[model samples]
Target: MVKSVPAWLRILSVVFVALTALILLAPLIVVVGVSVSESQFIAFPPNGLSLRWYSQVLSSNAYLGAGWISIQIALMVTGFATLIGGAAAIAIHRRQLPFSDVLATVFLSPLVLPTIIYAIGMLMFWSSAFGPVSPVTLALSHTIIALPYVVRTTLAVLAESNPYLEEAARTMGANRLQRLWFVVVPQCIPGLAAGAFFAFNISFDEAVLSLFLRGPTLTTLPVQIYGQLEFSPDPSVAAVSTIMIALTIVLIFVIDRMLGLTKFASA
Candidate 1:
């Protein structure tokens, strides 16, 4: 039998959860409030209510271009990262290749390494090999950084699955391709979906790599926000940020519906 918590301890736990939630959500609330403010400057309490800042954001050519670029890069990153990372995870889990442990570590090294270091190295390497930074460069860099998350999530789910399924399929006359397609791929779906969401979110919000690879021609949404904050920031910036936050929330909801958030947590 399990012992129940004391009332005082339960009350303290509730208070702690409430405090944590408030701390995490306060900035988001302020951003949404400022986005709707009529004030020329960003303010927490907001000075009156208006949607003109959002209208200005929608009307700005620079913002529109940056948003489109961000969307494209994020989609590309999600596709490449999910494919490459998921495949690598399966290979590593099967231990089919030499130095599987080392390969896994190498694949995940980007997660432990400082992103700024990778950004600088990427910038120099690209400048020497290619000529200037472009959308392709941004997409490739984002894929590299996002790959680790996909690999990790996929590995986690694979670890918890029945290890004998692949062998059982083989004994039942299923070829390699058939086993992978019908058995392994189905097991990896939840992890892949979670990782794809993570990849999309990271690419959409990435700044360091985008900043280092930035050119006169290339600008992503986060880079645009940074430029605005550096030069002239106003309520319009808050409006754009609010919209991005909303997009993130929607993605979270979709991920939850697709696989259930608890699946990820348990994985």
Candidate 2:
């Protein structure tokens, strides 16, 4: 029989778990609390509760426009990131590409570099050559950041799949494209879906690159929120933030349903 922990140790374990949970969840709790507050100014322990702010946000033209732009940019980033990253992962897994390690590192270097630094480089480069930054510039920058997540997740799923599946498919007279499409791609469905969601989230929530590349016409939701917060924020900002939080919760549930949270954590 498996041994059980002592009661004292179990109680201590519960305390540790509670502490860790508090540390991780405190900010989210605070943000949610503020979102529901009736006051104009933000506060953790809200004076009152009301839905007026949410109604105001829903009616705001500026917020709606920015949100539309953000969604479009995020969708584009997700598509490009998933396609590029998945292809790179497949090539790396097969060892068909030379200097795979170097290539992998190059692909993932964006994760290691500071976003601000990359933003500066992109801004200066665009300014020097392209003139002014545009929606295309924002999409490219977001794609670069999102690609690493796709690559890492794809590689994780590939690592766990049967090594002989591809070989077996080939032996059964499956052409290269047929084997890859039928056998390989199915196994990567969970990872690819997770990465696609990640790409969307990162691009939607991103601020640094957005700020650097922003024009009057190219402002994203995050950039718009940041602008308001830097001066003075109203309850509408809280409403917008609450919407983002809700979207994130929906995404988390979808990811958990498609692939266990542990699968994503491991990736």
TM-score of each: 0.92, 0.91
Please tell me which predicted candidate would have the highest lDDT against the true structure: 1
The residue pairs that clash in candidate 2, if any, are none
lDDT of 2 by residue, 42-157 (tens): 87697798888888888998899999999999999999999998888888877777898998899899999999999999999999999998899999999999999999889888
| lDDT minimum window of 10 residues, candidate 1 | 258-267
Number of colliding residue pairs in model 2: 0
> Among all windows of ten consecutive residues in candidate 2, which has the lowest summed lDDT?
258-267
lDDT of each: 0.94, 0.91
137-241 per-residue lDDT for model 1 (tens digits): 999999999999999999988988998998899999999899999999999998898899999999999999999999887999999999999999999999999
Alpha carbon lDDT of residue 4, candidate 1? Answer: 94
